[model samples]
Target: MKLTKIALLLSAATLLPNLASAGTLEQVVKKGALNCGVSTGIPGFSATDSKGAWEGLDVDFCRSVAAAVFADADAVKFIPLTAKERFTALQSGEIDVLARSSTWTSSRDTSLGLNFTGVNYYDGQGFLVNKKLGVSSAKELNGATFCIQAGTTTELNLTDYFKANGMEYKAVTYDTSGQTIDGFKKGRCDAVTSDASQLYGLKLKMDDPNSVMVLPEIISKEPLGPVVRQGDDDWFNIVRWTLYASLEAEELGVTQANVDMQLKSENPSIKRLLGTTGTAGKDLGLKADWAYNIIKKVGNYSESFDKHVGKDSPLGIDRGLNKLWTQGGLMYSMPIR
Candidate 1:
């Protein structure tokens, strides 16, 4: 289900506009829309609603940056991309930032001309299969046909996981998660391979979720996060810290519901994070209330996660490895100052 070559060519053409002489922050401001690259569809992380408007965890990342820069979360134009096209789109300057669920990897770091801002989702690859297949473990799927998204580590990881486990499986590669899931549901693949968090999102979207079982084998490390072109250190810092601010806000006990009250906190960390203690935002070329705009408008990471992908949502994914370092998870925010 890879996007046809023609589509990629068209994407390239669309992205061929002369790169602005200024940094990405200026381009975003001038264009009046923070062009964002997002997944084709992954419930709770990035998905289109019934009304065709995008909303999810990843979507909020883009919105938070928009809010910090433009003081409005809604000033974003999302470009939905297949995994195959996402890196190319970003590399070609088609989008100011990519809020897609992309796993950070060494090759991507050097070859893609992109910078992973930070790990928004600490994850590992996993398997999902029809319960009727009676597959208890990944080791048992020696002859399985794995449906995987192409141009992603998931594809190579699928091959590597099976090889490392001393098993053999064929792979049916797709550019989009929707195509992979649809193929899997139609019995075209024995298993669907992707990040575990994504497995949770896709499983909930399946027709017979109860019958679709995600295996317990946690395969490769997959730290899904945002990415941007490799240039303009200042612009990169703005994007990087915007993500950190959300995590820091959560760590410092700031939330959308309490941001207004937390502004006057005596705690130095809280004060700095909320723009009450210094001109940190100005140093980043953003308004003094840049972080405040994010927290007050977009909420903290925990708040967004709970609303979009937590216990109450249909995806219902446990925070697990994505929880803050204070909670014993890998999530750790950098100091704002």
Candidate 2:
């Protein structure tokens, strides 16, 4: 059932009568499933499969977290959410963690009563228009109507970009990304604007995917990541390290196919990451092999990227800023030791 925004907000508020008392991990453990909020339908990030199973990069992140906690990747209940309702759902404890492809912004971080663990994808806002539009640059999109999802940074970014360029346009807002793309396809707007990565995913839904062209001009920075409520440090650490474990596993040459072989390695970093020589997992209030379960079940960052949005997938997005720090990218993990 589709709940109205007001109803959803009130429902979320009811879940948390006491904001000060937080125990997300305990609640999740008692329930035996991690409640993960994800996008309603973003093909490469979070969408349902032919069998009605949620599968995508963000979905994999949720699975990884579940694996870390319960040693079972499937122990997660995927709650599909719209952009407008994601934060409130997280705030009200409607979901244990939000693996939605939400950007990490200062206002959201400081004002939303939530904590972003780390960036899962580094992206930039861009426009998607029909190839017939013949518009090559975002600057040339003056006076063009745009289809944008409401309650997203994309709307504000679009407004700011146009204002800075002294251009004016009409915004056709939708509650979900799929609806925004549908609005664009149905000619409600001349263009659709979102993170460039999402534009690729959206194009997959087009009648003729090749008809859509993502303009070259990237308008704004969008560091997308997972989020959890702020009060519980333990849950925060678990979520944060779960992401870091994926990245670190990639850097340490740990893939799902080879994790078992890696367990016997002598490298201190690998040993610590696999819980063969450290207490990092226990320190985070998780089992000693928390990272091991994540790597074993969900693979590493590179694996998940390749399987969901990289060259192996339809999106074909390059690692760019999502690559490891050692590989000249921004994905640096904190020390597990």
Candidate 3:
């Protein structure tokens, strides 16, 4: 019996760390608000208006998670972070989830003690230059001074792309996207390099947005997504499914305005996603209507995209690779059931 007790004790001890790791949901519930990390400012991604209200694609995502948990999208407290500060804020528990436009790379996923929920945006590195530079292609950028944000995948990609082409350019690094754009505007650099999606967003911030143009060269693949700290499967599921729910909603023709009617959907996939016929949310330690709340309050992925960064928005970006997998794009969700 002594041996039996020892074996049981060892088993219990082995489970303790996992139990502790899964406590993020409980802590968030007790706190009554979800702390979401986002970019300091990036138009159409994460940015503050003149009235200090935050609204953007990333901000909407943070709100979506809050809606899934609290059924109140406004229950999120947005914590603005820079590229250098984003991971540390998540690691130190200063934020419950990092919804910033963070890239999912091997090192960031494994070496940083973080887990990327999934890619929300598929981007590629590109360059932005003033129209007067007569640079229609990135190849024309040889010997140009490029303004770039420090501590980003864009930095390394820029270096790699230039060297691969046997081209030479000087880099003027800034700590923030705003500063990078400012440096470019002030003629501190001849061009600015970043993700193509970001280059579109940043252009809107320029005094003469029409005067700037993103070149036709894309250098690197950047799968941008939300991130959570490692060691918490429950929290990871919550964040992951929140995004997938949005994607699935769009694919199933569910929208913020039609979610209530979708609750009565007869299609199996729609029923399962809206929680009328499955325990998808309950399995994640949330109410059965968690995904329903996200769709209704924060909208589906396409809705968020169209509103924030697509044709209807100032950014006017196409859905290209961000479209559903069925529509010749890469966005796909796991089966809800």
Candidate 4:
């Protein structure tokens, strides 16, 4: 009898961690908000506005998850993190989801105890230099000193690119993107290197934006997206599908303004996506209207992109690789069915 009792206790103890990890959704629901990790401030990605509310593409992704769970896009507490701090915060459970402009790399996926949901943005590492440098191409910047964000793939890509090109350069690393830009502005380095999207965002922060220009060379592929802890498949699915729901909504011609009208869509894919039919929400431990809420509250991926980083916004970035698959770009969603 004592042996059986000891075995039972051991089994229960073994299950405890899984049980705790599985309750992330429940914990967020009880807490009344989802804890979302974002960058300190990346314009058109994640940043506080004049009203002190977080707004940007990555910010909208967090709102989509909140809308899925609570039907409230505003039920999110955004925690701003520097480059080196983002992953540690997620690993420590300081944030439920991380939506900073983080690249999805094999090392990060296998070693960080985290899982990237999917690529929300396709990016590449590039250089930003003062127009006065008279260098229109990255090749001209050989032996230049660069201000780079520490603890990012940007740093590694910079090293590899320079080495492979038989060029030598120096890197002055900063703890955050803001500091890197500041370092560049202060003339601490000849150029700043980061994901091209970020270089654009950083350029906008300059006293005179036109004084700097992003080099035409894209040296590395950066598939940036949201991330969640690895042990909880339930929460993982919730985050992953929330992203897919937005992409699917866009593919099906659903928008925040038109999601309500889409309820009557007879098309099977549209119906499944809008929660007019199917068990997608139930499979993910959510209400049938969960996706409907996300669409109605957060808008589709296109809407968020356009509003935050595309032509409608200050960034005015073109939807090159970020365009929907049907439109000849890489953004594609799995079938909701």
Candidate 5:
């Protein structure tokens, strides 16, 4: 009897970590809202509007996750974080998931105890400068000073690019993207370097948007996406598949305006995606119409892109690498089944 009791206790102890790892989804359901980590303010990505409501590509991704879990797109608390504070917030459980425009690098993936679910935006580093500087290309700025955001891959890339070109430069660092751009506008640096998409967004904030232009050189690859804490595979899958569902919806020609109509789709792929003919929802511990809720409320990935940062939006960014795979771009979804 003593031996049996000891064995039982040992087995239960081994299962404790697993139970803790699986609690994120359950805690979210009980809390009635997901705490999402986002940037302080990067327009077209995760910034607030005139009405003080959060809306952007990253914000929309957070809403989609809320829709999948609670059937309510607005059931989320957006916590703005800086680059240095983002990882700490996620590690401390202050936020459930991070949807900020953060890059997926090997050090962050391995040493930080985090896992990047998937890439939502494929980006590269570039330079933005005032056209009056008489420099049309990055190679012309041999000894320029750059305003860059601190605690980001941007600083390292800037150093590497200049070193490789046998040139030299100085860096003026800021805590947020907003401040980085402000430093540029104030002439604190000769140029600003960041992700190309971000330079576009920052350009819009200028008093005369056309005064600045992104340079032709792209120095580094930045695959930005959502991130979840390590050891929580269940929550990871929910977030990962939430992004995939949006992509798959686009592939199947489904949109927020037509998700209901697509439910009647006879195609097996559409059927499984809409939760009408598969165990996808059951496997995720969500309702049968979970994905349907995501599409109907949040919309497909392409829809969010167009509305926030693409051609339909103010940024007017052309869909280069972000185009769907069928169109020769890199946006591809995994099998829903």
Candidate 6:
């Protein structure tokens, strides 16, 4: 009887991989479009223009994945979601992946039944205050009122920071950033706090960005990235490595202008990446030239960063921690082979 029970467990384990892969990719193909979850409106991250067309870093991420699958970046339907609604949308299969800016945390990973692919942005919590407030540092803001969002890590982190610093603060909570910023503008709070990247984006909408300055201190690490439901490993791999493809393309000297040229190169890694030399794509249940589609359509990590988040954009953040590892940053991809 013990042997029978052990045999049943072993057989179930062996069938798991086959069961998971049996129709996931096929289902996506038959659907004709990838449904992507993204932030409602955050400039440079994800936002809808006047025409209601979605665009930004997160939008590009979804497009990149669509490019890999259908060879057409436009083959995607964007489902805009707020922070609280993102996970539910993904779990309900309303979206294939949540490309919204979400911090990767142990609790979110384990308890939430979500899989974070990898970090796209290395951000941190920070404070943005009017320069006239005469505050040079966050530590100086004792007993200050702050404009913050409710039901977010920003709120919890705000509480913990004040508690740890022995500071007193009044939190003027709001559900949306528009309301939070309006409250700050109306003098309801001395300071406004959120992710540092968000501070930059938010400040761009202010009457004068020079009037509001971000504090030098960045508290708490925020490794933000895309996420998906936990059960589908193949779907997870496709999304995760679609992000990695951008980074890898930049590292390998492939760009939108030169991906076609590089695809003909004789280098082993580059060839495997371009689908000329290996089964890398087939292993992921995608076309051999999956990376090529992303590179040709969406460009690479550097291109995406420069176009949306780098110095040329209003946010104008230096890619200090986001640069490729060889350039002394943390953007690294696992081996494609």
Pick the winner on TM-score between candidates 4 and 6. 4
Residue range 154-224, candidate 2, lDDT tens digits: 98898899999999999888999888988888999999999999999999899999888899989999999
Per-residue lDDT of candidate 1, residues 261-283 (tens digit): 88778999888887877878989
Q: How do the predictions measure up, each by TM-score? A: 0.92, 0.94, 0.94, 0.94, 0.94, 0.92
Evaluated at residue 136, the lDDT of candidate 6 is 96
What are the per-residue Cα lDDT tens digits for candidate 3 across 1-337?
Answer: 9999999999998666455556799999999999999998998999998999999889999999999999999999999998999999988889999998999999999887789999999989999999999979999889999999998998899889989999999998999999999999899999999989989988988999999999999999999999998789999999999999999999899999999987887899999898887789779999988999999898999999999989889899999999899999999998889
Better of 4 and 5 by lDDT: 5
**What C-alpha lDDT does candidate 3 achieve relative to the native structure?**
0.92
For model 4, the stretches where C-alpha displacement exceeds 4 angstroms are 1-20
Pairs that collide, model 3: none
Q: Which model, 3 or 5, shows the larger lDDT?
A: 5
What lDDT score belongs to each candidate, Candidate 1 first? 0.87, 0.92, 0.92, 0.92, 0.94, 0.88
Span of ten consecutive residues with least summed lDDT in model 5:
14-23
Q: Please give the lDDT score for candidate 5.
A: 0.94
Overall local distance difference test of candidate 6: 0.88
How many clashing residue pairs, candidate 5?
0
